[model samples]
Target: MTLDALKIPETPVCAAALEVAVAYCSPALLNHSVRAYIWAAAYGEAQGIAFDPELLYVGSMFHDIALMPEFDNHTAGFDVASGHVAWVFGAGAGWPVTRRRRLVEVVISHMLDSVDVAADPEGHLLERSTSMDISGRHMDDFSAPFKAEVLRRYPRLGIAEEFLACFRDQAVRKPDSSPAASLRDNIAERILANQLDRTG
Candidate 1:
């Protein structure tokens, strides 16, 4: 159950991308990002699909970078801003245009409800894994043992509260944006949860 089969690309590239991601994201967000990679890779394995591990890793790591207030561009949705950051990073690293575009697509497309995995396999896998992590969507797709192991290695670290704040921040900054439209209702629920946790 090692992840070696995913065929991750060069060490330096992976290392560099991770370094940037870890530096930019909060601890909870960072943990969530890492878990996204593991879950996506595990899902790909179960499907007998071969993904570009480097693309999956880097894309997953920075997929939510735009949610960070410091990095928020305000001009676009969080997904598009995150994609732009990855695109710029890849371009500066001298990655081929096609590869860089695909990487950006992987990050941006995860926000969509459906993606053409045949055209962007990494994006589809990322979406599945992210949905599982964020909303518990498709929770039954993986077995108990697999879920236990992944969670054991990387605990949630209270990501829900932290991510909710980030989501709210984005929503507030642009009321007409996707984040605002989607997360408006959850604000009350999360607030109630925070209050109940405090009382308990």
Candidate 2:
């Protein structure tokens, strides 16, 4: 489903939360995150899951706002974005501490822990099974020893299976292009399309 179709909560806090997250992210990443959120929310609805569309929207928007130049040198831009998202929205939202913690976890791990696109030479082929497995494992193994560092830092968060399912489907279905690459192409396309409209 398109983003327009989703019943995103229209509250000021929700909009403010999104605004802060988007402000720290690149335009391309912001757009891609919105697309991913819409996809995940739709999938949740289809499966009869109870997803808070606003929370999903906010979570997706801020998922990658942590891009600090030093920390993100070789990592994908989205990884950098994750840190800021947690800091800004999680701290600002005044959400239940547990909910805030989970939101941050979802943002940070959604792409990295779930969906392995590195093996596929072609970026766009949607592999649902691998994506689902990753999503399930992320929820199941979040408290594993390897993630203890993060858990210690965040302390109050946990991912639910249903929420993980939504995130997994979105990752599985994402266009093969890395989030950064997709956003770049999307921006270029929008610019060209706009220029063409004016000329035509």
Candidate 3:
């Protein structure tokens, strides 16, 4: 769905969260993160899934915060590390413990292959959107026109290459990390072809 049609939540806390996320992540990551939000919102609408706008927005913005130095937990996997970052950010924003718990799931589960949406729609939406953007795994659900409009509004600027590099470097630096264990195939294929895997 286009941004013009998507009802973006612009709560003060959401804006603040995104601003903090931008400050911590790379330009490519920032761009991809924002697109992840857009895609999540769009996918929710298409699937008739009800989601909290602010929750989805904040979760998507900081979903990969673990990759940044301030949020990185040297021993923790990227998923849990980023969840910790999101929890801290949410707490500072006056988010209640319940919401923070949900946000943690939303941010961390985005890396999972599939999620039980019945339990957490917000997390499921972010998971689908993250896959859609990072690997174009769900591009078929988003029509060509919609995809073009999104790209027009949010030019990739080599996000695929940059994000893959980040994932690769993370794997190298932390061999026991989640990315190394679960995403090695993606990095190897994308690196060899210089392309995001078109396959799901």
Task: State which candidate has the highest lDDT.
Answer: 3
* Alpha-carbon shift of residue 166 in model 1 (angstroms): 1.0
Clashing pairs in 3: none
Regions more than 4 Å wrong, model 3: 190-200
Residue pairs with backbone overlap in model 2? 64-81, 65-81, 66-80, 66-81, 66-84, 67-80, 123-176, 124-176
Single out the weakest 10-residue window by summed lDDT for candidate 1: 191-200
TM-scores vs. true structure, each candidate: 0.86, 0.48, 0.90
Candidate 1, position 41, lDDT: 86
lDDT of each: 0.78, 0.43, 0.80
Instruction: List RMSD in Å for every model shown.
Output: 4.1, 16.2, 2.9
Lowest summed lDDT window (length 10), candidate 2: 121-130
How well is each residue in 1-200 modelled by candidate 3, as lDDT tens digits?
A: 55698877979988898889778988778888888899888988988998899999999888888887777777787788889888988899999999999999899889888888888898998988887777666667677777777777777777777767667767877898868865656544534342233222
Q: What is the clash count for each candidate, in the order shown?
A: 0, 8, 0
Deviation from native of the Cα of residue 107 in model 3, angstroms? 0.5
Per residue, candidate 2 scores C-alpha lDDT tens digits across 1-200 of 33345566787767886676456545544444554454455455544555556556666666545432322324334443464555555667677777666565555555442433343211111112112222222123222332333223322122222223323333344434244443434432332332112211
Query: Where is the poorest 10-residue window by lDDT in model 3?
Result: 191-200
